[model samples]
Target chain A: MLQYVLKRLGIAILVAVTVSMITFSMIYLSGDPAIALAGETATQEDIQNIRRVYGYDQPIVVQYANWLWNALQGDFGQSHYLKKPVADVIFERLPTTMLLGACALIFALVLSIPLGVVAAVRPNSLIDRIALTIAVVGQAMPSFWFALTMMLWLGIYWRLLPISGTASWANFVMPSIALGYYITPAVMRLTRAGMLEVLSSDYIRTARAKGLRPMTVLFKHALRNAIIPVVSLAAVQFGFMLGGSIVIETIFAVNGLGFLAWESIQRADLPMMQAIVLVLSFFYIILTFLADMLNAWLDPRIRVM
Target chain B: MAERVLEVEDLCVEIPIPSGMLRPVQHVSFHVGQGETLAIVGESGCGKSLTSLAIMDLLPSKAKRRAERLVLDGDALTGMTERQMADIRGNQMSMIFQEPMTSLNPAYTIGNQLTEAMLRHKSVSLAEAKDRAVWLLEKVGITAARSRLGQYPHQLSGGLRQRVMIAMALMCGPDMIIADEPTTALDVTIQAQILHLLAELQDEFHMGMILITHDLGVVARVADRVAVMYAGQFVETGTAAQIFDSPTHPYTQGLLECIPIPGKTERGAHLGSIPGIVPSLVGEIRGCHFAGRCPYVHEACTAEDVSLRPSLDAGHEYRCVLSPQAAIANRNKQAAQ
Candidate 1:
């Protein structure tokens, strides 16, 4: 197991490096970085000074090497607009994003799994129809619209909860729901399909024949095997949630990494944008890698494969 | 005391299809006595497995089951609630299914599944359950029984997994065991070994067993009595010797003839086979279910249902129109004339 993890870590480093290379090049792909950094109204000498200071005169490979070496030493340079370290800017808002993401995931799984299981238990029943309808609605309707509706109904009309800001739990209710609603369908549908398949397997029949309690048969014998693929799907969805939080964050005024990312892009803060992209990509790759390993551990057959 | 383990009468299972209801097992009746091994023999799709599932009350939720009576240990199972049925299922009776490759859960260790029923049905401690699991495993001839407990189903070979399944069935010391084609997926050698183990264990525990198989050789060896099933009903039933030596129903005769007798028949002799198709189960079945497939099928045979009639022997019985001896004589006389 240790060897397996070490091998995966090696591959993860290579993937992270590749991601960094791409995000770094993306900023350079647009108009001259020196002009963008100096502003459109800057004089020619100012543009030259900015270019020389940032080593834009160096060859592309040399420039990339310099940035990469500095990045390894925890220096992604200062954000042009904020005049602060890119890491400090993104990190300041990390906790809020993490809290929102975690709560949304918990909410999605807690509600969706049972719904999926109920639907699978009695396919085409009234409950099954209700779950499918909810899944379809969740997948089809945009979260921004859903967010606005929640804001109108719960915030403005009922005054049950606060509309904006992440000051307290009451304020968090709308944003979490808006973000979590989008992925509920995927988790629910996968659970239902997985449960359906597992419920028919011979082991399930054996479990029934053994006279296990109905709940025990469904949850213990059936759900464990059913949740294998769902785990990987959950990890992928979590990563998407991290990246997808941008729009929801902007709407809710949750000052998080996603909102920072949006600010960095609009202001063309190249280093800040580069740092956010690199960090998010690193998280995505690490999550997928961990999911794969967890999957192998869940089912030994995959290890051999 | 004449101990009766299981008794079923007029048990039927019907599933709803696009065209309507399909009766896979219709009006099936049988009884199992203590220390008895009744072999239910039939070809594929003959509803043998379906009968066992119906008895276990584990039939597919969509399929409907009806029975005049289903009793186990004098307890009527016909009207029992699912909870009541579950209480008796692994406690008083259990099932050993075919295909050991899939019968055991891959996610669980052998010990966990084996100890489950014992723990559920009896007030046993965890340590006691583990001990019983080890004992049962050793009883089924699995070496290093305690160590095998930690292994998953896929970690073991097919034969070993089957042994584990058999041991699992024996965990609670059930009064009855329904083994549906227990050795069908095993190699011939392993098949013999497993059957031997089952027979030995059954005798030791005095457990009534229903062995369902399509192999005549398996029936001839371990069965005390044999019931030949065809398309959801029994065509013939008698002592093992009587069913083999004097098969009255054409279906039973054809099934016996299909088995090659190595020492009796010539080496190059053409193996016997019954031609034609098994009648469909859909729509109302008005006659013998095997009439269309029987070589001696007369118009009278297909006109109405034929129920079981007693043979000359005190206990032997078969479902047919002709008397046992008369049917054999009539066929012989036809050849002479």
Candidate 2:
């Protein structure tokens, strides 16, 4: 187990390095950073002076190395747009995004797993058909559009849940649901497929023959094994939600890092945007790494190999 | 005779395919009494396993099972609610399937699975359930029973897993057990050991056991009575001695002939075999199901479907146009000629 953990950590570090390189270059290499920093009206001499001051006059490689070195110590340059440290800007907004992402993930699992299990247990039944339809429809709609309509219908007309902004749990209801439903289809589909396969296994038949209640057999015998593959998938999905919550958060006014990312992009805030992408990608890598380990622990067959 | 434990009459299982409905098990009827072993012997895809599943009401969702009278311990089970059946299942009857490795859930420790049945059916405390699990583990011949309880199915060898499976079936003290080719996936030596243990446990508990297999030697060794299934139907059933010694149906005869008798078969000579495959079970059928494959292909054999006809001895029955005595005499005449 220790060896496995060590090997995973090695991979994690390699992935972190790769992600930081790509994010750093993608943001820095694309446009005129000096002009963007000094404004379009600046004279050539003024631009050159600004470039020298910000180290944009330096070679791209040197600049990247210097930037990476500073990032290692939590100084991702200053966010000129936010008038604060990049790390501080990101950390200030991290809590809201994490809360929304966590809520959405919980909602997705709470809804998908049972629906998937039911659909699998009684395939082609009414409940199965309804769940399938909901999943398919949810997957078809654009997230921003879905969020808009849901806000209109539930928050405006029905007056059930608050439409926009992160005021309270009620304020979270729309965006959380919008983001939750985005991944629910994939989770539900996998759960149903996994449940169907597990239900037919010889072990499940043995479980049934044991005279266990249908629910007991479905949950204990079938679900535990079925959820092994789904856990890894959920982890990947959860990672996506952390970063992918951008669209839903923007539409619903749930002030999180997603909104910050959009604002940085609009204003061309290079340092803050770079920090957001790098940290989010690093988080994505970490999530996937944890998911693989969780799967290995759950299924010993994979563990031994 | 011991009290009758399971009585299944005219059980039929049909699955609808794109072509039509496939009759996988049709008009199969048999009964098992306490302390008795009824081996349903047939080649693969001959509906032996389906018949066992039908008895347990565990048929796949696409397949439909119907029986005239499915009774266990004197209670009717023909249309029992899934909830009611749950109570009787595992409590009164449990099943052991082929491939013990795949029959035990990998995620659970052996103790959890073993105790689950007893706890589910009875109000036994967890401590009592654990003790029973240890006792059963020891009974199934596993050493270090208490420690073995903590291990998962993947930790055990195939032989030990099979033994654990058998022990699991006995957890709730079920009156009947349907072991579907329980030893087929194990090594030959392990197979013998498992059979011995299963027989010992069955005898000790006096449970009515239905052993489904294709091995004639296995049937000869363990079965008290035998039913020879052929393509979704039983063509022959009788006491094991009668089926082995005085087989009647042509299909049953062909099956028996396929088995090599040691020292009797000439060295390097081919053992007996039946020609042709089992006929398609789709659509309507007007004649004998085995007509295409039987060696004695009479026009009358295919003219009409056949039902099980009894011999002079009670319960000795077969599905064929010719009587057992007449078929034997006919064979004798052919030899003389």
Kindly list the per-residue Cα lDDT of model 1 for residues B1-337, writing each as its tens digit: 2487999999999999989789999888889999999999999999999999999999999899999999999999988999999998888999999989998888778999999988888999989999999998989999999998888888899999899989888888899999999999999999999999999999999999999999999999999999999988898889999888777788887777788887977788777788987778876888778877877778888788899889878678888777788877754564354
TM-score of chain A of each: 0.94, 0.93
Task: Give one digit per residue, the lDDT tens place, for model 2 in B127-230.
Answer: 99999999999999999999998888888999999999998899989999999999899999988898888899999999999999999999999999999999
TM-score of each prediction: 0.96, 0.92
Model 2 chain A TM-score equals 0.93
Model 1 clashing residue pairs (backbone): none
Q: What are the candidates' individual DockQ scores?
A: 0.69, 0.67
Candidate 2 chain A: 10-residue stretch with minimal lDDT: A296-305
Docking band of candidate 1: medium
Model-by-model lDDT, in order? 0.88, 0.88
* Best DockQ among the predictions, by candidate number: 1
User: Which residue pairs in candidate 2 have backbone atoms (N, alpha carbon, C) closer than 3 angstroms, thus clashing?
Assistant: none
